[model samples]
Target chain A: MWTFLVTEIMFFGGMFMAYIAYRHAYPLAFAAASQKLNIILGAINTTVLICSSMTMAMAVHSAALGKKNLLILFLIATLLLGGVFLGIKGVEYHDKWVHHEVPGPNFEFEGADAQHAALYFSLYFGLTGLHASHMIIGAVILIILIVKASKNQFSAHWYTPVEMFGLYWHFVDIVWIFLFPLLYLIDPRK
Target chain B: MSDHIVPVRVYWSVFITLLVMTVVTTSIAYIDLGPFNLLVAMTIAVFKATLVVLFFMHIKYSTNLTKAIVISGFVFLLVMVFFTMCDLLTRNITAPGR
Candidate 1:
């Protein structure tokens, strides 16, 4: 898991570098682009993800304690929180799609240095899209775990899968933790 | 395979701390700290991440080998970021035309 997270770090690290370089090159444009993002939604989503991480951690704890019902309950709660996050993200993306903020010919940022602003949206989609994909996968894993946990398949002696999934879910939450500030709260103009 | 079960109180406290930090970060972002804005935001973020890592992920209760592996991941990430920034920030200094 540690090795896999390292590779994931390198993966997201490159994009982070790109974002920093572009933000450095076009600070004003980046700021303007960032202002268009919905900070409230972003904060709420951050909280939701954090709560999900807590629930996931608790699920692992429950599994470790051989508490089958608590494990299933927490797993279900985590799954629901993950779904709410994606739902909010879908709303944000739909807003952008309607506003034509997506990076393409239809892309438009009514501000100085629109070109770099477009680059901001590009990274925005790339980073959040990847993060959301991980959330989807995590949700799927939680569903499977929920089923197995309901069947009393896990116990204190053998809950490695639950612990591993906790790591993965927390990692995903960590990614969003960074993404929230970088993408949403980065408005220098505010 | 030493399994340590963290108390619910720790998890709840960490969650509350993370939420508080999130609020603090958002408030700080609006304060116009000049160049310190980014630094402040990232510092808060790193702190929050540490809380998550230590408690939520149970790295604090992990074995020495597990800790070493996790620390190495961050070390390599630092190396990557540092070298990459060095190249990026110094590119103009060694430009062929300059």
Candidate 2:
């Protein structure tokens, strides 16, 4: 799990460097570009992921105590929270698509640095796409855990699966921690 | 066995605290701190990440080997990002852009 997170961070680290270079050279453009991202949805997803993180912890907590029912409840909560995050992400992506904000041939920008807006889109898609993939992996893991948990597999002595899954989930949350700033709070003109 | 296995209150408390840190960092990112913006943002991220790894993942109570392995990995990662930034940030990309 630590190795996996290191790779993810390195991946984001590369993009973060690009962000730094571009934002330094063209602060105005990056700022204008940043404002174009949907903060409302970003904030909503933040809340959603927070709820999911809480649920994941509770799931492990219940498992540590060997409470099957609460474990199941928290596991289900984790799954539902994952779905909500993805749903909100979908909405955010749709908004970008509608606005021609996504980097592609059809992209349009009216900002001072419209030509460099592609950089913002690049970072946006690259970071968030990778994050969403992680979220999917986490959801799949919880799905399997849910199946096993429902069958009374986990107990106080053997909750390693839940612990490992928490590691992965928390890593995902940390990715979002950096992502929110790079994507939404760029311009800060408001 | 006893009813208490994990400290539910402490675990949940740390998780929620991480959430709050995320919000606080994001909000602060909107203030335009010149170069400090990214610095502050990443610093806050590191803090939240630390909390999750230490508590949610139980690295604080992990084996010596586990802790060492995790810390070494983080050290290497920091080096990688650091060197990459050194290479990227020192380049001369003109305003109109090279």
Candidate 3:
């Protein structure tokens, strides 16, 4: 699990480096692009992810304690929070689409350095899109775990899957921990 | 293998702290901190990531080998960033001759 996560780190690290390089090259454009993000939605999603991480951690703890019902409950809560996050993300994407911020021919940016601003949105979509896909994958895994949890397939002696899933979920949460600030809070105008 | 079972209270407290930091970060972003804006934002982000990694991910209770592996990933990423930035930041823009 650690090995897989390390690889995932390297995967995202390259994109993060791209983001940093562009931000350094086009600070004003990046800041302008960031100002267009919905800070409220981003903050809500961050809170949701943090809550889900808590539930995931609790699920692992419950599994470790052999509390079958509590484990299931926390798993369900985590799934619900993950779903909420994806829902909010969808809304944000849809809003960007309506505003013509998808970084294509129809993409629109006003003022000088519009091209550089488009680069910011491109990186934004790339990073957040990858992060959202990971969340979707985690949600699906939580569903499988929920089914097995309901069957009492886990116990204090053998809850490796639960612990592993907890690690994965928290890793996703941490990615957003960085993403929220880097992508959303750079320039919270109003 | 018996793993450490963190108390429910710790999870709740960490969750609250994360939310508080989120709010603090958002509030600070609106205050126009000049050049300190990015630095302050990244500092808070690193702090939040540390909380999630140590508490939620249980790396705090994990073995030294696990901790070493995780830290090494970041170290490798830092090396990549350092080399890339060296190339990016040291370029001569006015050199027209090959």
Give the winner by DockQ. Answer: 3
Docking class of 2: acceptable
In order of appearance, the predictions have TM-scores of 0.97, 0.88, 0.96
Enumerate residue pairs that collide in model 3: none
Overall lDDT per candidate, in order of appearance: 0.89, 0.78, 0.89
Give the per-residue Cα lDDT of candidate 3 at A20: 86
Q: Please tell me the TM-score of chain A for candidate 2.
A: 0.94
List the TM values for chain B, per candidate: 0.95, 0.76, 0.90
lDDT of 3 by residue, A1-190 (tens): 8888999899999999999899989988998888889998999999999888888888898898899999999999999999999999999999999999889999998857889989999999999999999999999999999999999899889999998988888888888988988999777466
Against the correct fold, how does model 2 do in TM-score?
Answer: 0.88
For residues B37-96, what per-residue lDDT tens digits would candidate 1 score against the true structure?
888888888999999989998889889988898888888878877887788889999889
Highest TM-score: give the candidate number.
1
lDDT per residue (tens digit) for residues A1-190 in model 2: 6676667667777766676767777777777788777787887787788778878878888888789999999999999999999998998889999999988899899977787877778877887898899899888989999999989889889888887788789778877866776677665646
